[model samples]
Target chain A: MEIKLSAPITKEKLAALKAGDRVLLTGTVYTARDQAHKRICEALTRGEDAPFELEGAIIYYVGPSPAPPGRPIGSAGPTTSYRMDPYAPALLDLGQAAMIGKGPRNEEVKKAIVRNGAVYFAAIGGAAALISKSVKSAEVIAYDDLGAEAVRRLEVEDMPLIVAIDSRGCDLYERD
Target chain B: MRELDVKEITEAIAGLSKETNVSLSEDVKSRICMMRMKETDEGAKSILETIEKNIKIAGEEDIPLCQDTGLACVFLDIGQDVHLVGGSLKDAVNEGVRRGYTEGYLRKSVVTDPIRRGNTGDNTPARIIYDIVPGDKVTITFAPKGFGSENMSRIAMLPPAAGEEGVKDFIVDAVRQAGGNPCPPVVVGVGIGSTFDGAALMAKKALLLPLDEHHEDPYYAAMEDELLERINKLGVGPQGFGGDTTAIGLRINTAPTHIAGMPVAVNINCHVARHKSVTL
Candidate 1:
């Protein structure tokens, strides 16, 4: 059965999810890819504030196409998650609740998710045009120079995802 | 010699760049439809359905099928009998890429430098490969390549003694290791018998071939069929959900190699294999 999740997911809510659970996520999620993740990590190392609130927030690893004249965003979908492995633990410690991306995560990230009460979700890769239907609005919130790689605040409605790794570190990518 | 204006070349490239991004070629679409019919895993089947729907949406709405939009990879078959007028060919290609990325609203994914990475703002300096052939016409093939699958591609150099078995094992192993990362159901492009770089180039070039097309050599064509069977048996399935259709197609290209060494390369392209061609 599919679960309905809203962003700023609570610890209790996240704890209930398990690997292979389908989810329809609604509410706000922040977009960040390689460059933005690097900057966020750098800021954390320097004891500076991150570009957005970390508590209960979910970061989507994506670099979206430019919005057409009338659309809110164009063909926004998950990028490979392994690229962000280096910086994911730090964000998890800062109270980041979940992540939406595709592909396998490293061992370190799996450990971080388990220890920090976080979950990892997979949005279907290459289903960008279909996924974009859920995005209601988007505006760049940081690193505008990064172009598509910039961090953007996206308000998504009923975005489909699958729980690839739960807070307990039950990973869908791993064979039983 | 036939005179072809650089402006015409630029315009053709620009038009192709946009066209390739938003639509899947008929051959690719047919392959996907066939896979969809055979896929059994519920998750994999649903993913394929979404992909099919996305293709339609992208076409009707005139939006890129994927946000990556990819780096412009232009392959040119320039005829020796054709003379270029106006600006240099390279500049015209880059201009075409710049205008296409901007006007088409495709994502600009290229960076100014590899290490000190900064967005070039305009996707410029397309990866252009040229082959001079005997004709009066110039044929350009534009393939927009996303990096997700590109990152999973690999090359290996084996001793000549490793032979056919070694090549098959290597290709299968590469696909196994890539798992869900390259976005299966993928198209596996294999290049055999060239230097390191040449093998890699051939692997990429192989992707430009239609999915239904087989290698010219019967030997290589049979190898492709065998490799595809082994890869699908790995059960990576669509997006690695474990299904029957792990790979939609496999294309192999071969070149004469140095007797001392056997070089092979694997280039994996996601199901959204985007390419278009125009002759000017």
Candidate 2:
């Protein structure tokens, strides 16, 4: 069923989701991919504040192409989530409530999702141009040196997503 | 010797880079359209529709079909009778990539070093493969390879006794392991025999062939059809949601191998499979 979700997703909302549910996420979400995830996790290990507020926030794993003329972002779509597996649990511990990416997550990531009351959503992997249309605005928030891998705060409207993993640790990637 | 200017090569590559990323080839487009018509799963059907719409928007707006514009992979069939003039061939190719990525607004995905991991700022130092042929023309085939599928590729060294069944098993297993990560309805390229590196290179080279082109050898051609059918039956479906079309095409290239070993490699390409060619 189609459902609308906003950022700072709460435990109640995550609990209501299950694997395979269609979702339209609308709100402020942060973007980071492999390099940025490594940096964020390293910073947290040093007891430093994350570049953006992590509590109840949703992070979209993407490194978009440079925006074309008059566009907020260009060809934004989810990257594979498994690359972020090593660092995801740490972000979950920081109360990051949701993640938007594609592919299967590791067992540790799935367990962390269940324990932390978070959800994992999959955006259509190669449908970048279509997905970019929902992004209303985007601004680099940190790690600008990483170029496309930089952390960006994005405001999105009805971004298409599927709940690939739920708070209860159910996963859509698992064959029935 | 016939001489060709490096500038001409650069310009051709630049144009090809932009064109391939924004537009799907007729062969690839028609295959996807045919698969979409036969797809029965609702989720998989919707994903295919989104892919079609994305292709249209990217073409109309001159934007990349996907955010990961990919590493520029250039394959050159250089004629032995032709001389490259004006500049270093490598520099000219990189220059073309830089211009294409910048002017085309494609993402710069290259890193200066594997460990240090600094962005190149411009996508440069394309993965270039050159082959000397018996002609006066230099044929440049540009395939922008995204890592999502590249990372899923696998290489195996099997004993000669393992034979054809072993090769088929390896290719199917690799695709199953890749699942949704490479993006579903992927195009698979299989390289058999040769040394490890040569097999891997052939696997990548196989991707440059048109989707409709079958293997020249009838035996391998039938093997390709069998492999494609088995992959589709995996039910990984479109975007791994489960459906009928898991892979659109599978191509196999083979060469003589060492008496002691048979090396095989599998290279996966996402459905976008963006590539273009120019003969200079």
Candidate 3:
């Protein structure tokens, strides 16, 4: 059945999502993808403090479109999730609670979610425009020179997403 | 001599690009409807419902259907009789792509270099292919080919005796292997012809067919039917979430092969198939 969602969701709420639950979310979320991810991973490698606090934050796996005249964001949707697999284990260790994207994550990412009290949310893959409308405000947070791939802070309202993987490692995708 | 200026071509290209990116093609729309009716797995059917709703919201809101927007791929068939007047056809198309990608606020996915991996600022220099056809007309088709579907496309050359059954095995196996990665209930495009590259092109071109339309050749149509049945049986299902409709549609385009060998290629497209054509 269709259900609305909110950000900063607890592990219990996230674990509630089965395959068919439709969700609409709200609250603060951060954008990350290939460029931003690489930067974050590199920062971790260098023992340098990264741009944003990783403690209990939502990291959206997206690189959004440029905002038009008066809107807050352009077509904003989830990118493929697997590309972030290598870096996710690190973030989970840092206490990031939620992830948003499409496709499946690797086994390590899933296990980390369980270990760190985190979850993965799935925004509709191609429904960028619809998803962007939920963003009330947005601003660049780091990696300014990386262009669209830079990390950004977004204050969203009723941003819709469903749980893809929960803390218990119950995946919503195929295994074999 | 008329100059084929960037102004009109740019507008048309931008418009075509926007229309294609936001809305599902008519053929795709109708085929999904058919699938919704025929799908056996409840979970897959529910996913299909969300997809249908997503399309509706996209059109009504005039938002992009998917955020990826895809790498710009332009196919041009210019007739021998007409000459471009003002701007070069390539520039006009590129300019159109730039305008379409920018104004629409679509993502700039085209990278400038393969190894270095630099973004091209604007999604320019579309992957262009031109064919000289008879008469004085120009037709342009844009397949905003998304990465999820593209990464899974494959090509192979088989012995002539491997024949149709071999083709079926490869197609089904590819889907089974791809699992949930390429997005499910995929549109499978099969191209059978000479050489490896030709097979690939044939497969990509096969994606141009109307979803519900079938090949005129009964033998080929039967193969398409058999392939579809086998694919569904593989149980890859919708979104690989487990269902009956592993594939939403299948189209095959064949060409005469060399006497010595037969080549085959299969290109898998996710359910979000976005493509369109314009005649100028």
Candidate 4:
């Protein structure tokens, strides 16, 4: 079944999700990858405010190509999730409700998902051109020096995703 | 001896770089279409269809097929009889990469210092693999390699006694371990029987081989056929969703190695498997 969801997804709504469910996510989502994740965790460790609002946010693991003429963004697709695994639990602890990336999360990340009622969604890997069509608008909000790795707030419309792991810690990857 | 201007090389590189990123090559596109037609799993089939759509959209809009346009891997096969003129070859190549990426709006994915981590801004300083051949022309092959699969590549120095079975096992296991991360329906490049570093280089070079072609030697060709079958049976599928098309193709490149040690390297590439060549 196709599940259409908007941003600031609540735990109550996320609880109903399970592995292998198709998701059409819309509204606002933040972009963060390896460097952004590291910086966010370091800021949190230093007790400084996160660069963006963490609670109820869905973070996408991507670093898009530069926008061409007449487009909001360039080919934007999910990077591997495992690279962001180390910092994922920390973000989940702060009530980050979902992550859109490709591949399986580490065990700690899965455990944290169960603990915090977060979900892990896999956007199609390497399908950037088609995926970019879903992004309506984008603006870099923090760490602009990181270039492609900068944190961006994106307004999306019907971004296709799959529930790779759910709040209950059931993983689509684990299915035989 | 024939003299060639480096400016021609620069112009060729710039155009080829943009062209390869925006358009999916015919061989790879056909392979994906063939796999999609034969795939059974609904999710896998749907994913393949999405990939087909992405290819078309990218070509039509002149957009990159993937976000990671990748660190430019430029291979130059220069003929020994040709005298390179006008400017330093390296500078010309980097300048070409700079113009191509900046003009094409491809992502500058390179960092000057691996540890310090800073974007070079224009994807300059390409990973140029230069070779000298017998003729008087330069052949440039540009393969923008994405790290989603690069990170999964492995190099193993096995005892010569371990032999062919050991190599096969290692390559298959590497793909299995990689799972969904490298993006399945991958093109696997294997380099065997060289020095440690050479093996790894060969593995990456193997990626440049056209998917429609096979190794010249029938022995290695059969090995390629068997290994591809074994990998597909792992059921990694398209995007690892579970199906019969885990790997679309596998290529093996080999060189002479020391009697005591046999080196093997596996370089996996996403379905994009992009490369474009120009002879100047």
Best by lDDT: 4
Per-residue lDDT of model 4, residues B1-280, tens digit only: 9999999999999998899899877888899999999998999999999989999999999999999999899999999999999999999999999999999999999998999888889998899999999899999999999999999999999998888899999999999999999988899999998799999999999999988999999999999999999998998888777899998889999999998999999999999899999998
* Candidate 4 structure lDDT: 0.93
**Against the true structure, what is model 2's DockQ?**
0.83
TM-score of 2: 0.98
Candidates 1 and 2 compared: the better one by lDDT is 2
**Residue-wise lDDT of candidate 1 within A14-116, one digit each (tens)?**
9999898999999999999899999999998899999999988899999999998999998998999999999999899888999999999999999999999
Question: What lDDT does each candidate get?
Answer: 0.92, 0.92, 0.80, 0.93
Instruction: Record all residue pairs in model 3 with backbone atoms less than 3 Å apart, i.e. clashing.
Output: A5-A24, A25-A159, A126-B65, A126-B66, B2-B85, B3-B85, B3-B86, B4-B85, B4-B86
Scoring each candidate complex against the real one, what DockQ results? 0.83, 0.83, 0.52, 0.89
Worst 10 residues of 2 chain B by lDDT: B54-63
Total backbone clashes of candidate 2, pairs 3 or more residues apart or in separate chains: 0
Error of 1 at B228 (Å): 0.5
iRMS of every model, one decimal? 0.9, 0.8, 2.0, 0.6
DockQ of 1: 0.83
TM-score value, chain A, candidate 1: 0.98
Error of 3 at B15 (Å): 2.2
Clashing pairs in 4: none
TM for every model, in the order presented, reads: 0.99, 0.98, 0.91, 0.99
Q: After superposition, how far is residue A161 of candidate 1 from its true place, in Å?
A: 0.6
